[model samples]
Target: MSSATIRCYIGIGSNLDVPLEQVKQALLELRELPESTLIQHSSLYLSAPVGPQDQPDFVNAVAEINTHLEAHALLDELQALEQRHRRVRVQHWGPRTLDLDLLIYGNESIQTERLQVPHPFMTERNFVVYPLAEIAPDFIFPDKTPLSDYLANCPMGKLKQIQI
Candidate 1:
């Protein structure tokens, strides 16, 4: 684990088993992560499933945190939280009880067998980008692109913010 704390953003989504409550619970759990503090989070948003529309709509949000844990350790913690929520991976872009994606890690770009920071597809997904823009409107990607750039090109489509 790194002693230095870094600001990070996590994308949260769920389309199964009371998705609204699932996202809310995950936000609370994010606050409890070891070596990390949840700084802020975006309002819950409702969005259509990214793939396989046969599933239910998803509830999504973005969380900002400062963490002393290195990127992979933080990823571990997020995955553990998902397991506690009973997330399963049986199909590609399948419905899940909870989905936690590490969107950015302090302006660092990371790519490895197990993790990717500034998640590759975030720029193309309104469910991820819109909620993220809500919490960190001025954020810049590791690649030096402004969040606004993606916002300008990514249509909201069916995304809608909902009060929980």
Candidate 2:
């Protein structure tokens, strides 16, 4: 963790073990992360599963936070949250009790064995893009493209906003 606060974005999703409840509970926990403050969160959106269609659709949202934790430390906190929610990774993009992805860490572009800031698939997934754009419309990617540009490419035809 660092002494300086850093603004970060996180992608959240769940489709098992009462998906909506999982998201809601995770949000509550997120607000209490050590050295972190959850600034804002986007409305939950229902989206089709990215992998096997045999599972339930996902409930997704993005959260913005200010934290003293560095990128990797933030990721550790997110994973711990997921574990608390009983998340299990049996398959890629599979159904879970909760999933937390560190989408961006300030202006950093990180690629380590354990984490990747500016999540690799955020721009391509409406689930990630729409919520992110909703809260941080002015955010620019590490590539310098505005967040709206990615949102434009993401079609929300199948993504439905969950009435909170």
Candidate 3:
């Protein structure tokens, strides 16, 4: 793992097993990650499911962290957290007990078999983009485009912020 610290944004969501509590617990777990410091987190929001309509609505939030772990290692830790929550991958964009996505990793653009920085679908997902903009309003994409640019095209849809 690189000794250099990188700021990362993690997108959190859950629609099963008491989603509100699951997301809350995930934020707490993020604070305890080895070699990482939780910087700030966005307010939780409720949004309609992105894929199948048969599932429950999701509770979402974004967290900022500074970490000494390499990108893949960070990914490993995030997945481990998911496993601890009993996350299952039975369908695409399916209901999950917990969903933790590495939305951004500093300014680096990473692409490998196991991970992709600046999560490919982030810009199009209001749940990801809105919560991200909440915590990092001035954040620019690794490609140099301002986040506000995406906000213009991505409608808020049914997303609603919830008081925790």
What's the TM-score of every candidate structure?
0.98, 0.97, 0.98
Q: Output the number of the lDDT-best candidate.
A: 3
The pairs that clash in candidate 3 are: none
lDDT (10s digit) by residue, model 3, range 68-132: 99999999999999999999999999999999999999999999998888899999999989999
Error of 2 at 23 (Å): 0.2
Off by over 4 Å in 2: none
- Which structure is stronger by lDDT: 2 or 3? 3
Clashing residue pairs in candidate 1 are: none
> For residues 1-164, what per-residue lDDT tens digits would candidate 2 score against the true structure?
79888999999999998899999999999999999999999999999999799999999999999999988888888999999988889999788999999999988899899987788888999999999989988998878999888877778879999998
| TM-score, model 1 to reference | 0.98
Instruction: Give the better candidate number (1 or 2) by lDDT.
Output: 1
Worst 10 residues of 1 by lDDT: 155-164
Cα-based lDDT at residue 71, candidate 1: 96
Give the residue spans of candidate 1 off by over 4 A: none
- For candidate 3, report its TM-score: 0.98
Displacement of residue 9 (Cα, Å) in model 1 is 0.4
Residue 85 displacement (Å), model 1:
0.3
For residues 18-98, write the lDDT of model 1, one tens digit per residue. 999999999999999999999999999999998898999999999999999999999999999999999999999999999
